[model samples]
Target: MQKLSPVPYGSLIFAPMEGITDEAFRKTILKLYPEWDYLATDFLRVPSAGKYPLKHLVTHFGKELSDVGWVKDKTMFQILTSHRSFTVEMVKDVAQLGYPWMDINLGCPSNTVTKNGGGSSLLLDLNTLRSLIKNIRENFPGRLTAKIRTGFHDTSGFKDSIRLLNDEGIEMITVHGRTRDMMYKVPAEWNYIEEAVKISQVPIVGNGDIWCSADVDRMLKETGCHAVMVARGALKFPWMAQTYKRGFREETSHERLQKIKEFFQEYRTQLESESISLRGLLKQSKSVSRYMLDGVENGEAIRRKLLLSQTPPDFFDILKSL
Candidate 1:
């Protein structure tokens, strides 16, 4: 199998989860730990010319976001579209913004996005896909990458589709193990991702079913992809990125619990600094904090109470009492 530089190929990555990986969350992770190799913004849905205002582009990556020190050069902006013209215009605008890298989302499975000829729908039209990618390359300034699934429904036409992308000079490719039709339901078909690794020329990143640092190692050992990106895993356990960076060696349950406590304390400090009200602060961590119980005792019960937590102090008291 081919090998990349010593840089951890399994560098934990935060998927461009719309509404979930926003500035508030990104800041929380960055401040708490610097485990992620790069951060890809949630897909910026661009319908047509004049539809996506510059401010819209700027808001997601605009002043406030751009100022986040952790995201500056490390962040990749991902845009979704069906029209090559629209894609080119958006690329051009982002180029003007001085971004060093950008990604095109061809893996989104949202029904509304697909019906509009965007996201994975472009997969059905190879010619349109090639045209749009070509426009992006010709217009955008820095690194260009594409994030895709194994295929739309069947893997039959996947090779030709991937070839078109490889031939177009994309800098990298990140493939989610499932197709558009599969959504996030079934286990990721690592074998199919193995097939893609053999065919694609650019560096490949495997993403799917990676729930922990060990999972990251196993995915790389099995797929031969250059890197692995973690979405739900990172969300489930914020320290996942940090854990991988520190290596996947086993830890005692008590040690692991200690790490969890540190994560919560650090995260709480960040929330407080955001000037969010105490109640609001705890509410924000509710969804993701539940993930910390992965290796803990009575984790499900803890997650249940935390999910239903009404206030910051209430959640803190529960955590303390536990």
Candidate 2:
């Protein structure tokens, strides 16, 4: 099996968004625009209390991303968990598979993740967070990175969190600048990002509200972050990395729509190749179409048509109309 290498941190990176940053999306996005810096996998839910087997939890780790061909090296597996031993075990297992990097997902704000004491909820328990980091650092000798929000509720411990990361030798950290309460509300606190940059010893990747190339530039200039991670921004504009690489070139409606069509085809190929149920595929198709509709004038209308699609033929017909 061949290994993929990580993309250099030039400027832009794809944020690890659950249910959105799947292998198909990364592979397709890279095919269209190869300038993206790095991509973190959707957080892997670690097996807890030895209830589930390790093989079950790492279902998508080696095979799914590796089969995607080119994303092997550029992608890092992100693990979400509230237990120290489980995190250490998960990292060790992947490390044995020749996986070069492991990223801890400390910033996921989803209710499902938080209610279980996994995501940003860990932020409220800094002691456990620190122990988890330290254990992973000791167990996994290779590169280790962590993603985080400013704080659990308010960013009161933001500085302490940075200090913990540095002390534990986290090579890279991405800060989303929003607390659990914020939940991506209006206006990302870039000022908070700027403050994190000033305090951190390692490179800080700034995330949140970066809608276009200009926002990428603004993030770098204002926050002095080493890189920018785009989540909702990439969904809203799939061509963002390409535009940033091309100096933010303007794309006409026709051209952009064509790209969205290509995305539909790319994602369909991915779904069909996998072992998924029809209902699951349809749901995925509808969700992706919603994302692809972003700023298009006829987006809602097109999305409605896609939801009405009952079969593969119906979905393809809608793409043809696009």
Model 1 TM-score, all chains together: 0.86
lDDT of 2 at 195: 89
Query: Distance (Å) between predicted and true CA of 187, model 2?
Result: 1.7
73-101 per-residue lDDT for model 1 (tens digits) = 67778888887336677788887776667
lDDT of 1 at 135: 82
Q: In candidate 2, which residue pairs clash?
A: 4-73, 5-73
For residues 1-322, could you state the per-residue lDDT of candidate 2 as single tens digits?
A: 2323333555677888777777666767776667776776788887775534555544555356654534556677888888533666777777766566778888888898888888898889889888888888888866788899888889899889888899988988889989878987857898888988898988888998988778998898999998889988788777788888878775777887888887778877777777668787787777766666766778788878888999767877888887
Q: Residue 167 in candidate 2 has what lDDT? A: 91
After the best TM-score superposition of candidate 2, give how far the Cα of residue 284 lies from its true spot, in angstroms.
Answer: 1.2
Summing lDDT over every window of 10 consecutive residues in candidate 2, give the lowest-scoring window.
1-10
The top-ranked prediction according to TM-score is 2
lDDT of 2: 0.78
* Over 4 Å off, model 2: 1-9, 51-58, 62-64, 67-70
Q: By TM-score, how accurate is candidate 2?
A: 0.91
